[model samples]
Target: MAVTLQDKLVVALSSRALFDFEEENQLFEEAGSQSYVQLQLTRLTQPAQPGVAFPLVQKLLRFNADGQHRVEVVILSRNDPVSGLRVFHSAQENHLQIERGVFTQGRTPFKYLRPLGAKLFLSVNESDVRQALEAGFPAARVFPDSIKSAEANPDEIRIAFDGDAVLFADDSERVFKERGLNAFQSHEAQYAQTPLPPGPFVPLLQAIHLLQTLPANQVPVRIRTALVTARSAPAHERAIRTLMSWQITIDEAMFLGGLEKGPFLQEFEPDFFFDDQTRHCESAKYAGPTGHVVHGVANPR
Candidate 1:
C-alpha cells in the first residue's frame, strides 16, 4: 500500500528484538528514505530469544494503520552474532521492517550503551518523555491495541509527562530549592489542600485532553497522557488533588519514591523521558529514548 504522511512514523527497537543485520537493513533501507531513523545501536554478546517479552519492541509494533504505512524498526546493536540473529528473527516473525548497523565498537562488556552513534533514545519517564516531545519527536513510542482501547484509539500516538517542572511551572522545585525542604513540603501541603496554579505545559495538556474527548469520528489527532512522578505517599496527595481540580484525567500514574524509574518505565515503554535533573534522565535514557535539561523559567526562552 502507498504510504501516507499521516502514516509516517519513527520507532526504537529494544536490543532483544534484533535478529539479523543484513536482512533487516535491506528491508528498512528499501522501505522509504527519510521515513526511518535509528536512535540507538549496540552489540549484544548474547542474542535475544523470541517469546521473552521484548516489551519495548512489542509496544512499537502494536499500532497498525489502514496498511497504508508499515512500521519500520531500527535495531541499534554492536557487531555481535547473537544480537544479529535476534534482530533477524524479530523482523521476520513480527512483520517489522528492520535497520541494523554498528553504533559503537569496544571491548567493554556493556553491549548496549547510551548516546550510541549520535542518535537519541526516548525514555518512558514522565520528565524525560516530556522533554523529548517538547524538543519535537512526538512519535517516539508506539502504543499497542490493548493500551489504546483503555483510553480510546490505541493507534493514536500517546505522550505523557510529570507535573512540576514538566507540565507545570518549576515553581514547586524553586520553592523547595530556595525555601528548604520543610518549607517546600509545607507549601505543597497547603496547595495540596486547595487548587494550585496552572503549569507551563497546561495549554498543551488541555489540547491533548480535548483531542481525547472528541468523538471517535471527529478525532483526527491521537494523543494521551499520564502523570508519573517521584512525589511519594502523602507528598503525592497535592499533585493528585490538583489534577482532579483541573479535571484532567491521566491514563496512568506512578508515584515512585526516589526509586529507579527504569524498570517501571520499561513497562510503559514511553517514546522519551524528559527531566531537569540528569540523574533520572541518565538511567531512563538507557532503557528508552530521553531528552535532557529543559530550560526553566529563570533562563527564559
Candidate 2:
C-alpha cells in the first residue's frame, strides 16, 4: 500500500545544505543549465557512488502522487550549483516534485510552484524562506546533521522548539536583556520555583504536545519535542527545575552558554527553529529549517 501524505515523511532543502555550490557554480556556468540538468539527472539515477559518506543525496526522476509528500528545492541565487542536482534527485525519489526555476536570468522551469497543491520553491534569503512558508510552502535546509533519519518514522511528523518566548512568556528575557545580568539573575531567582506566564505560542505547543501524548494507536502518528536553549550550568538548573515543576517532559535539553548552536541543532535536526533573536536564528538556519520569529523582551537595536 502506498503511504498517504500523513503517512509519508517529507523534507525540504535549501541550496547551500544540498551540495558544494561555490565550486560547482563555475562548472554549471560552463556546462549551461540544460546540459547541467541532464548530467545531474544521470548521476542521481546511478547507485551510490563509492567512498561517499552518510547523508548522501541520491537523485530520483519520478513523483509519486499517492504519497502526497514532495521535495522542493529553493534556489537562492542564479548561480546555485545545487539546483540541478536537487531537481535530478526529486525525479528519482518518487516524491511529489516542485522546482522553482532559476531565480536567475535564464529561469529554469519546474513542475510545481502552484499555490493550491503541495508547495515547493527556491528561496534566496531568510526573508524568501519566511515568505514562502507564510505563503504555505514547507521550508527545509539540506544539512546532514539536520536530518534525524534513524528516529524519523514515516508515520509521523516531528517538530521541536525552544522554550522561552517560543512556548512560554518572554517577560523574563526582556527583564534580563534590558536590566543586565544581575537584574536578570534576581528576577529568575524570585521566580525560581514560581511559574511564569505562557507565551503567545503556548497554545500551539499544547496542541502538538497533546498529539504527542496521545496513545500510539489513537494518534498513529508521533510528534516529539525538546528544549534546546543557551541557558547553561547554574542558570540551566532553574529552567530544568521549572519544566519539572510544570510536569512537562522535554525529549532533550541542551544548556549551552553563549555557544554557537548550529552544531547541537544539527543533531536535533528540527523541522523548524524559532527564536526572538536574529543572531541565533541566522546561525541556526544554516543547520536546519526555522519558523517565524517570535518577539522577545528586547527589541532589535
Candidate 3:
C-alpha cells in the first residue's frame, strides 16, 4: 500500500522559514548561486539557528509526543538538494522531529503541497505562498523579520486568524476594494445569514477545530484559536454568523474595525497570526509570529 498523509495535520514549510538562512540568502543575492551552494555545503555540518517559524513548528510537532502522530512538519524548500542536507541536519541538531522534505533546487516548491496533504504552507517567498493559496491550501508568506513572543506557553497552542480572505472567502473583501466600506457592510449584512465560502485557511481552521473537540485527557495539549479581524459591528455580524453556521468556535474574536491590530495582538500573544494584507501582517508581527496570506483583492501581488 502506498503511504499517505491523509489522517495527519501536515505543515509544509520552506527551509528559510524554518531556519535562519539570511546570511546564506545574502550570499546568494550578492555573489551567486554557486557561492550560496558552496556556503551551504561548507556549513552542512553546522546546524542553522531557528528562524521565525521555528517556535510555532516546534510547538505544533509537540502534539505528537504521545505517539499519536497528529502533526507532521515537512520541509518544502526552493533550496538545492545539497542545501536540503543541511536543513535536515539542522532539524536533527535542534531536536526537531521533522522527517520529510523536498528540495526543488530553485524550482517553485508550492506545487508539492497537495501530495503532502498540507494544511498549511509557510515560506518567506511570496510567490510560492501565492501559488499555494491558489492551490487551495492555507498558505502564508512568513515574515522572517523577527521571532515574536519567544516565551511560548508550554501547554497551549495559540493561533490567530484574520476573518476575510484568511478564513472566510475574499468575496466581501473584493466588494470593499471595488465598492467602498458602506457597500461592503451592506453586502455582508445582506449575507449575514449566509456562510461565506471557505477561504484558503478554512481547512486549517476546520482541522484545528476538530482537534479542539477531542477530549482534553486524550490530547494532552490545549488548542486556543482566535479570529482577529478588521470587520467591525455590522460587518462583524456576518463573520460571526459564518462561523456559527459552520459550527466552529474560536476562543476569542476581536472585531477591531480599522484600529491597529498590533497592540491587541500583543496582549493575546499568539504563537502565530495570519492576515491577508501586508499592513495588518506588519502590525501583527510586532505582537507575534505572523504569516501573510497573500490572497484576495487586498493583496494584488
Model 1 C-alpha lDDT per residue in residues 154-181, reported as the tens digit of each score: 4545455655666556777788668876
TM-score for all models, in order of appearance: 0.47, 0.50, 0.97
- Cα lDDT listed for each candidate: 0.48, 0.48, 0.89
Candidate 2, 268: how far from true, in Å? 1.6
**Top lDDT: which candidate number?**
3
Model 2 bad stretches (over 4 Å): 1-156, 241-246, 298-301
How many angstroms is residue 236 displaced in model 1 relative to the true structure, after the best TM-score fit? 1.3
Q: Model 3: runs farther than 4 Å from truth?
A: none
Candidate 1 lowest-lDDT run of ten:
139-148
Q: Using lDDT, rank the candidates from best to worst.
A: 3, 2, 1
Total backbone clashes of model 1?
32
lDDT of 2: 0.48
Q: Which of 1 and 3 is the better model by TM-score?
A: 3
- Per-residue lDDT of candidate 2, residues 177-246 (tens digit): 7787678777777667776676544544544454466556544345556777766555666676766766
| lDDT for residue 9 in candidate 1, whole number 0-100 | 38
